[model samples]
Target: MDLSFLSEQVLWGISVGQLIVAAVLPLLGFLAQSVVRRLLRRVMSRLRKEGDLSVVDDVNRLLTRPLSFLINVALWNGVIGLLDLPEEPLSIHSWATTLGMVALILVIAYCAFHVVDVFAGIATRAAEKTETKLDDQLVAPVTNTVKLLVALIMVAAILGQFGYSATGLIASLSIGGLAVAFAAKDTLANIFGSIVIFSERPFQIGDIVEISGVEGAVEEVGIRSTRIRQFDQTVSILPNQTFTNVEVRNLSKRESRRVRFEVTLTHEATVAQLEDFLDSIRHSLAQRTDLHPDQSMVRLTKLDTNGLGVLVQAFTISTDFAEFMVTQEEILLRVRRLAEEQELPIMPAKEVRLSGEVGEPRSS
Candidate 1:
């Protein structure tokens, strides 16, 4: 074989060899990272089990992220060196290309891992601050905002690494702002709405609230809207911005659920019977343990030509809506039974006098 005559074929062979070297090392690096991650996780788990750490320790654990990142970067660098390209222009180009690919992978992975760490730290700090309650609505948005910012930075860094100026990318986005704004107007509105809801905290998830005249239990509070489960078992989606401008009634925040209702007395009932009726209502409410028991009051709030209006007021012992309704029903039923026992008319009264008397004063 004339070896000098096979120049082109020799170059092709070298290229194929370089490709094989580059491919195998990165695969090996990935496998090594997986093994290393598993080992680290196991060790951490063991340490967590044996160590005297308070159950509330999430901040210090995020400290592991930088070490994990360095390890991953080292493995990637090892793969690049294994390619073993020459110092010549062609070989340098190949090495630069290979390094670019490795760097891109490392950058994406590092950004993702760092975001997780940041989010974990955020959650830990939030947990430590509030003991009796948590502002959980904040975590998702705060973490997501950090992740999105980090991702954008990573992308810009990657582009800059490829010799594309990141400043130019931002400038380009600025120039395209009008179009972007027009296209994403609704999305921006939703984002603002999310911020308002998170900051104002008109109502939280699992709260029974009434907004825009619709009453329901809040099922979820999302970035763009909120989900409500109505009493009829239907789910309603309300734009988050709607809450920003509308008056939101959070029923859960009421200190005492007030029960206000009017009971009617018959026209034929005497004044003595009305007093007896009022007393019976007060006594009936006193028997329910679910009610405040101490604050029960009944009075003749109104009297019309048609009937006597007895206004009953009581405070519930619980904020729970279902229990409040049950207590209310029990009180109403008891009042009804007492009224019947005293022969107090339960229906609204209407006296029939001649219409001729409407415009004329009749002598008593």
Candidate 2:
């Protein structure tokens, strides 16, 4: 180990000691990066065991790599400056500085992305507390939009490092205004569609709705589309713009579901017998608490070529489909027993395509 060699010039007044320092900084930087990353990972692991938090995963994705890159770039920049590298024709110093700036911009954007996730988590918690599901639907779109803006700003900053005027280009619309407009037309329409959905509120998240012949429970309402989970467990994604000028039937909004059925009698039963049977059926439905009080009815609605038709129609107070099915089944069983008691020859009407006990119950 000669002490004189340590002070000997290596290049452009930079010593062997400085070159050794240059070589050593990167090793230290690398070690520091791994240690910090491991520490953060350990912290995240502890958090995961305590409670479920969305931001835990967000921090790992949005902070780890960019932060490590930032540390590496900073160390690299320091080494380039320490050597006093030449700036003529091509310069490592200039390259390092530009790279560092780009790295800084990226790290900042990633931090902003983490902020967006944090905001989304806060918004989601708040939305869950409210009664209206409309707020719940709004969280994703707004968060995604903000994240997208952050990404665009990050790109602009990186571009600026290379001497591109992002603002001037945007102001001039030099990329071709018509082309940009055409490109964004659908996106603009979708944004407006989301606005209309929020304002008009044809259906909320979790509502069973039928739109454009597609029926399902709305799983999510996003800026561009709506995700619907159908009865068969298949998901349907419809463009938000589709809601603008279409009919949407909110099945959840109904006060009651209609219960209707038609039964035919062989001409064996006379008018008086049929009348008494119908009255018994009406009276039976009226006594039940599940069926609507005023809506219960049984009448001879048709005098057809085949036979006399006894039509039964009522409404159930509950909106639950499973409960509605139960109510319909009870009514059908009751109607059958009543018809048999009266000694009336009854037959299920072939014309009743809805397939109910008395008739298929149609929702109203």
Candidate 3:
């Protein structure tokens, strides 16, 4: 190796030593980043074994790349300061500094963006420990709000770096915010409605509920809309604001379900037969464990030109619709059997009238 020849050779008006140093600076930065990453991996492994890794995992994910970029920029800046290049009309150092600053800001913004996810993960883990699911549902919206805030801050910082006044920009946005609010009123209403859902917890995922005449099981409660899987195998998407404004009946939360209907008998049924029929039906209902004994009733309700109407009203102990329907069918079947056994005909009454003299018909 000829050291004298290497020193004499010039590239970009700099000697071989300055060029070698500039090239080595980036390599050193890369090496430093690798070492830090390896250390972080080891720490993560240890934390995983300890079973308390949420915070550590979040920190590693949010800071790893930004920290590496910061180290690389710092080394490059140090190398640039050490270089003895000729200062011309266009300064290379100034351009390099500006580019470095821009990169730094970008890296910082990226870190800020990912930081929201980390915090959200931490909050979710914390929420899982408690019984209430409202906090769990809140994590997503809170994360989005935090990301938006961080993005705004990053934009402000970038503008400030470029010698623009952020105050003026913010004031301008403030003036335009009213128009934006008017334009996005429904969107904002939905977002607020989601907040209300999380706070109030009118219904939960998988709950059977009736909202705006749509009865179904709740699939997902989202920021903009709620997805409900209907009983007829159809999905209904209602805006979140609808829940806030309209009624929501959570059937799953009910303690008991009422079953009420009128059973008609023929006009030939005597009073004793009807009373016996009611007693038998009431006794059968009392035997069923699903029926609420205290709330059960069977009595003569109305008498019309059709027949005698007996009102049968009872409350089932179960709130499940399927179970309630099955129990109701069983009760009705028992009532039909009782009517057949008692010789009381279960039919609608008919009125016969002769308006004029009967005429003889010819045989065909």
| Estimated TM-score for each candidate | 0.69, 0.71, 0.81
**For model 1, how does the per-residue alpha-carbon lDDT over 246-272 read when each residue is reduced to its tens digit?**
889999888778887888776788988
**Alpha carbon lDDT at 154, candidate 3:** 77
Residue pairs with colliding backbones in model 2 are 261-358, 261-359
Q: Summarize candidate 3's per-residue lDDT along 1-364 as a digit string, tens digits.
A: 6677546648556777777887888898888999999988888888888897676778688868778877877886677666654557677767766666776777777777777788788889998897756567678877887888878887787777678899987687986878887989999899888888887899887789999999999888788888899999899999999977888999889889999888888899998998899989888888889888779999998897778889999999998889999988888888888999999987754568656557955455
On a 0 to 1 TM-score scale, where does candidate 3 land against the true structure? Answer: 0.81
Kindly report which residue stretches of model 1 are placed more than 4 angstroms away from their true locations once superposed.
Answer: 1-49, 52-98, 101-105, 108-134, 173-175, 348-364
**Candidate 2 regions with alpha-carbon error over 4 angstroms:** 1-85, 132-137, 167-177, 266-268, 303-307, 347-364
Ranking by TM-score: 3, 2, 1
lDDT of each: 0.72, 0.85, 0.82
Model 2, 29-137: lDDT tens digits are 9899889989998889888987766657766766687678778778867887788776766776688788878877877787788778877877999899988798988
Please give the distance, in angstroms, between residue 208's alpha carbon in candidate 2 and its true position after superposition. Answer: 1.1
**Number of clashes in model 1?**
0
Candidate achieving higher lDDT, 1 or 2: 2
- Taking the candidates one at a time, how many backbone clashes does each contain? 0, 2, 0
